[model samples]
Target: MTSFAQSERAGLCDTFLEVGPDAPTLCSDWRARDLAAHLILRERRPDAAIGMFLAPLAGRTDRIQASLAQRPFEELVDTIRSGPPKWSPMALGSIDEAANFAEFFVHHEDVLRGVDPSARRQLDAAEQKAIFAALPRIGMLSLRSCRVGVVADAGSYGRRSLRSPKDDHGNVVLTGEPGEILLHIFGRTAVTDVELDGADHDVESFRKTDLGT
Candidate 1:
């Protein structure tokens, strides 16, 4: 089976090439060029990538990412298309599959869905399974502030708990294909098509929650 990670990478690369550098992304204040720089530095320069998560290091990270963004646009996009550097954790097959499946998927959507509001990708069963498998961990990052439990509806991929204290009644039951759920959890709630079922208060809270980047 083709790895979802590779598929997403290829798709994202193609979009980047198609759209050119100045196209906007769902990531606020970022364009395609900036996204490409982020992908490159995230894999090639661990020192600066830390800035993405570390407040004290953010300035350096921004400066480095800005520098990379200034490179020839095609070169930057090609670097992203070529995959991660050899020394990076993402270079390992297992790690790449496990770590980057959703990273690339979400970013690809960021580019695609941002450019075309009417766009929607129908993910296959295997792709949905991969996302379902990875949901628990990724959910922790994206739903850190969410108070409701997130349950995926039963389907070919089976049911999965994306968050704690799975309560079918009170907690939010997120009904959709895994890709939509992933996008919703990844802060694209306004764009992704998903069904949220829960008590009024819980659903409202879930709606207001900041599904972190």
Candidate 2:
């Protein structure tokens, strides 16, 4: 079976090429070319990739990404479509599956959903399972700073605590298909359709929380 990672990567690259370099994306201020450069840098430039998590290094990362953005658009698209070079750690099978599945899935949506009057993509069970498998880590990464508790309830698949009640704020249980939950976690809350069950205050806060890019 083709892995979700591989599927999403191909889809994302195709969309990037189809849309061309100047097209808008859901990612704030990023055009198709910019997004392609980002994927390439994250996979190929280990030293610069650290900036993704380090605020101090972000400026340097941005400079490098901008320089890369100036490369021939077709070359950038080809690099993204091909994925990480053989020498990179992400080139390993297991690591690539773990890391790229959600990355490419989210980015694929970023391109597709950015268009006017966008419709949600139809995800298969295997793709949903891939996103769900990464939920614990994604939940912690995106929601750790929020004041509400998050339980990603993937029925029959299992329930995982994304977070505990950070304060007196009520706990919010997010029950939905893994793809919807992934959209919410990635800060596309306004466009996502998921069951948000909790106090109004908590739900509102959760929606407003800066969940990152």
Candidate 3:
């Protein structure tokens, strides 16, 4: 069976082809071609991927990524679709899913929703469960900037107190599917359907805060 990470990677490649290189994406200023180059660099050139998170190394990473972006867009997408090479840790079957699922899921949506905000993917049951299971840990990291506390209500999957309520900030209830909630937490609030139920101030504060990297 194809893992969710693998499926997302394949689907993203197909989307890149459909939209073409110049297509815009939810990722800041990156076009489809640029996002493709970033993915390839992240997986194939681990040395520079750190720039993705660290500030000081970003210039080097950007230079390398720009160089990679100059490659034919389709070729870059093909490199991502083909999966990591044998020498990379991502090539290990045991680590692939854990390593790529959230990364691919978010970036996949970034590409899709960049063009059509309402284009949300309907994830499978197993995928939802797996993602829901990961919510608490990632929720903490992603929502670190939120002024209000969050309770993720994933319907039947379960509910989690993503962050403890601050005395002054209050708490917000985020009601939605695992996938939608994930997007919202990752600073894609405008495109997500996750309903925010809370006091007026809390809801507004939640929306105003920037979440995730």
* Tens-digit lDDT string for candidate 2 (1-213): 667888899888788778889988888899988898898889999899899999999999999999999999999988887877989878887888888888888888888887642568888777777788889888877886789988888886678888888768878899888888888888887667778899999998888888844
List candidate 3 segments past 4 Å from native.
none
| Number of clashing pairs per prediction, in order | 0, 0, 0
Clashing pairs in 1: none
Question: Deviation in angstroms for 128 in model 1?
Answer: 1.9
Relative to the true structure, how large is the alpha-carbon lDDT of every model? 0.86, 0.84, 0.89
Misplaced by over 4 Å in model 1 are 165-169
RMSD per candidate (Å) reads: 2.1, 1.8, 1.7
Instruction: Tell me how many residue pairs clash in candidate 1.
Output: 0
Estimate the TM-score of every prediction.
Answer: 0.93, 0.92, 0.92
